[model samples]
Target: MGLKSSQIKQLERLYRRKIAPKSVISSQLVKDLCTAAFELGRIVGLLVNRRGSVENVILGDATRLYLPDIGRIRASSQRLRGLRLIVAKPKKKQRLKAKSNMVFRPSLYEIDHDFIVDLEKLRLDLVLQIQAHVEAESKKASLAIIADKGTKVEYFRDVNNISFDFSQFIAELEAKITSQIKKAHKIALIKGERGAAILIGVYLKTQKAWKYSLNELKELCVAAKVTVVDTEVQRRLKLDAKTVVGQGKLEDICLSALHKGAQTIIFDCDLSPSQLNSITDLTDLKVLDRTMLILDIFAKRAVSRAGKLQVELAQLKYSLPRLAKKQTGLSRLTGGIGGQGPGETKLEVDRRRAKDKVAKIEGEIETLKRQRRLRSSKRHEKKIPTIAIVGYTNAGKSTLLNALTNSKVLAKNELFATLDPTARRLRFPKEHEVILTDTVGFIRDLPKGLINAFRATLEELKDADLLLHVVDATDQQYVKHSKIVEDLLGDLKLLEQKRVIALNKCDLVDSEIAHKKAKMLGGTCISAKSRSGFKDLMAMCSQALWPKDIFR
Candidate 1:
């Protein structure tokens, strides 16, 4: 996801410390930071208002915490004093009692930043006497990149104070940032107190997902049930974490989370356990990484009992290694994509209980697998040729399956529609029956851990007599998608298997044009949505899997 140890150390040599800014913070960092912030805002519509710090950003809802950038100390327009020690506001329940000892987390983004101003204790009386200023609205401040623009300088304002649209502000922010750091090639992302869940934007594709790529990653957050009050992306976003964005941007994310009432910050990229803890410490919000989101979707779509158990087992194994980070907020951790676990603290005995539970579940799955195999063997004994449909997520494999066999599988325009291997028997006109199985979708750079975990399920593909490689015709990234699937199949050691590439969504493109593409590539073309080319696809399947001698 980032610089190798030696390379990072070389960078440290230039800066003289690990926390010092490196070349990585200048190029892609701001973009990634904006993404995280947008995601945070989407999940929780909080604000990174000026109320957070003295003329700086404060992120809190029922609880308010202070934050400064994690980098070098720099002079600010705001005033500071020696006596102004940060403290949490008194709760309604605690107003009658003395305020207890509590820890207040300041900003970690500006780790190099701290104030050494001198002020008398009398100043604390004046400030703390009022408790804290209740800001009707936070200040929306503008930052000039006399320095680095990749740093999404934080400011808050009352919504009534601003006249301009937030999106325009973000576009201009990117322009100003890039213009400031024209020489720097890398970007830096500093979210939360520390940079967490950051990832490099490989191959700067202007388009994302389908051809229409989102300039704002906050869109993913909105999709994940987060809200968006405001977002600003500085140019030169840095990729510090493989999953989370940056620190400066994370403040905005926290702000958005508060605004939208989102308790969980789900990253599009996966976060390691260490990184997860680091971000949570800063934001005090549950952090769900990219893998967790995928797993969550799996958990939701798992209708079959075996499918649910398999996903649960994989999720438990994935979470167990990460239990060390989940100390104070284990009960608060709800089952998002990443939070699939027993919610039990691991005492010495708890570990044994978990291990025993895992073994017992595995034994049950083994029994279930035997039952599945018996059914497969019965089908195999009858020699009803089987075909497995496999492709990148949302490539319309389920739609194709539904169209081909008249089965009622949920055919949504979403990813991972089919988790279980759904098969229905289809009899060819020549009196030959074939079994069609719909399996999980593939993606680029699928993790080795998940691949190993889903091995039992994926092995179902290995027994197939033919592979129906479905490609989304409407996808401009089909070339890259095709390569990813090919690489996965090669890794699965099924590269030599006989397969037919079914270019689905032909209705989206002109049939003549799609068929021309198919003919040129020597593949089948069909529009599962429109049924424009389904007959040709079926004929090809029958020709590929069955002999003509029986009908003749």
Candidate 2:
């Protein structure tokens, strides 16, 4: 079709006002004109005066244009400034509606009026159809441009052709977007209530064992008010002596921590001083092994002065060895048997301070131990029976104590929730009364430093008339936990004492199953939350503590 008189006038105005003034037409303006013309269902060409001798033509829809005589021609729009616009006619007439539906309705209206209405409807429909076709072709071209990877590829005429793999570009863009999202998520988590930590474990055991241990570590972290974002576990026949994990695994762990925005790395097992240093140095993140994590929980949970002293003493003892190990120069100082001339380094000074702090805390603990003994002696004079509640961490010991004495203690589901020992009086039948004390919970690999430092508090156990070993019946590792507590009791030399086991958390398990487990472990099933089966537990305690008495 030919251009209308009005369209030609508009084009002349555009050229005079926007195009003719510039010596060279901008590539953007060329692209705009081409896109507009193509949308209007017209193919256009730019005829430019090149060097005033020959005319050069630049066509829209570059893929349809061919130049057989030119070898590997490159298209450029920089020199096409004083160009005349050329519009090509459509190859075929576009149909507005299906021909089968068209019919002459002579009886409906006057002939001229009906013909005009039908022709206008057809014209409107034709424009809509052309717009739809243009949109479909545009989408197809975009997809082709994105998917093309061959050595020779055609690009849009107005845009620069940059040789690159579209697939690789899209992949890299997606990765960058995903990384930004993760970083924002991590920042939100950090700026919220809790800090983030990554848990790492190296185990020679089965996956089940690793899961169990790592879960406990996670609980410990929770109790300390730290969020564990991720965990990494490696299974090997032997653990790496320096970093606990192999070098490659350590690097992976570091990268994972960085990606997760974790500020700390927690190990499942205790690390030696040298191992801790090596891992921290490599990761550049604060590293804490299982023992130190437990100590941190205790430090946060301890409320009483005595409890705080015990925790500090343990921490100082643990740090002393690390401090000594940090001073590699100390070995040089001890070169000869009689050579003692070198002065103290900063590490030595820190070690000395740590030792002094340990001594002060130990002396305070001894004084407290003495005071505890005197109190115990006074209770013994009154002939009052005493019962101690002991169990694994988070096994509901504090809940059991609260249930028995009707006193509220900090009973939480997290490990090491209650660090300070709590004591309450429980009155039995016939005015018989016994003092029940709740001690710190035990774990599988309880730190030796903790045990030694808490001796002042644990000394209360030695004078007990009977031991109430509380066991968590609902724990999947209940049996292992029971063994751990029993082993610890044996180490404390309280195994020979009169003991009664109260299978706690029976509310979480089937009654029959709990009863069976209690029987197998020689315990009485009870639920602290529901206060079920406590009468039997109390009767068993009475028999064990005051056998042959009328109260029993």
Error of 1 at 502 (Å): 0.7
For all predicted structures, in order, the TM-scores are 0.58, 0.66
Error in Å for residue 163 of model 2: 9.9
List runs of model 2 lying over 4 Å from the truth. Answer: 1-194, 324-342, 550-552
> Cα deviation in Å at residue 174, candidate 2?
15
The Cα error of candidate 2 at residue 75, in Å, is 48
Can you write out model 2's per-residue Cα lDDT over 415-524, one digit (the tens) per residue?
88888989899999977899999999999889999999998888789999999998888899989999999999898898888999989888888989988999999989
For candidate 1, lDDT tens digit of each residue in 99-210?
4685443221120111101011011101110112223122122221111311232222321232434334434644553443332211212221111222222222333442
For candidate 2, what is the TM-score?
Answer: 0.66
Top TM-score model: 2
User: What ranges in model 1 sit over 4 Å off?
Assistant: 1-238, 241-246, 325-352, 547-552
TM-score of 1: 0.58
What are the Cα lDDT values of the candidates? 0.53, 0.66
